[model samples]
Target: MNRIIFAAAALAASAAIAYAQDPIVGNWKTELGDTAAIAACGSGYCITLKSGKHAGEQIGNFNGKDGSYEGKITDPDAKKTYDGSLTVSGNALKMKGCVLKVVCESQTWPRL
Candidate 1:
């Protein structure tokens, strides 16, 4: 009985650790009204469109933690990629992409 209890406890602890490692893993509603799914991919997170015209398209890749992340974002319409960063607050995620480290565009996405 003690061994069984220990195993259960270990499972629960690992689950919590996994969640804490990537609090941004979930679906979000983009400013343009599309659904974006962010999930762990390889060493970081991959953002893919789950709805709208761009469904199934991977638009972003980020690596970071504690509500802040940095990586690359793609403009689906333009077929261009830019330096990007993400900031999470409560149920909202602020995404920013920059061109030449000067011109930047930002959008806030709410968790779905």
Candidate 2:
């Protein structure tokens, strides 16, 4: 009985950990004509919390409007940063992050 109980508990724990992996648990690139870099953002306003290459980055968050948000991105390694506003369309994470005040690049990528 003790062994059986332990086995059941272990199974449950493993299942839970597996479920914790979000849908956006993969690599994602920015769309064309946009500069800000982004990854797969899971459901419910979830965004990637990145470090190393891009640290201290930020994006915009809108005022209760769908697909309207602001974000800030930082790449400590590259010693770079991107700041701008964006919106998530039906199948894209649109970004236009910039430095100081310049819109450099943007792109659309399939969510991985």
Candidate 3:
């Protein structure tokens, strides 16, 4: 009985660790007024459009922690991919995409 209790405790600890997700895992309202979902995918997070004209499209993939990330972001309308970085603070997520690490555009997405 003691071994069983120890095993259960170990399992609970492992489960807690496994499910300790980042704050960026959730849905947000994009600058375009659409909904975007960010969820864990493999070793990184994937951003997908959950509403509006671009629904069902995956627009970004990022890898990082503590509210900062770096990856590539794709413009659905232009069909272009750019180097991107993201920062999350409070209920806002600032997304930036750049060309050659120079010219860039940014948008702040609110948590949904």
Give the per-residue lDDT of model 1 (tens digit) for 1-112. 9999999999999999886766688999998899999999988999999999999999999999878999999999899999999999989999999999999999999999
Candidate whose TM-score is highest: 1
lDDT (10s digit) by residue, model 3, range 1-112: 9999999999999999767868788999998899999999989999999999999999999999989999999999999999999999989999999999999999999998
TM-score of each: 0.86, 0.42, 0.84
Error of 2 at 20 (Å): 18
For model 1, what is the error of residue 72's alpha carbon versus the real structure, in angstroms, after optimal superposition?
A: 0.4
User: Candidate 2, which segments miss by more than 4 Å at Cα?
Assistant: 1-46, 49-65
Model 1 clash count equals 0
Name the best candidate (by lDDT).
3
Candidate 3 regions with alpha-carbon error over 4 angstroms: 1-19
How many angstroms is residue 65 displaced in model 3 relative to the true structure, after the best TM-score fit? 0.6
| Model 1 residue 49 distance off true place after TM-score fit, in angstroms | 0.3
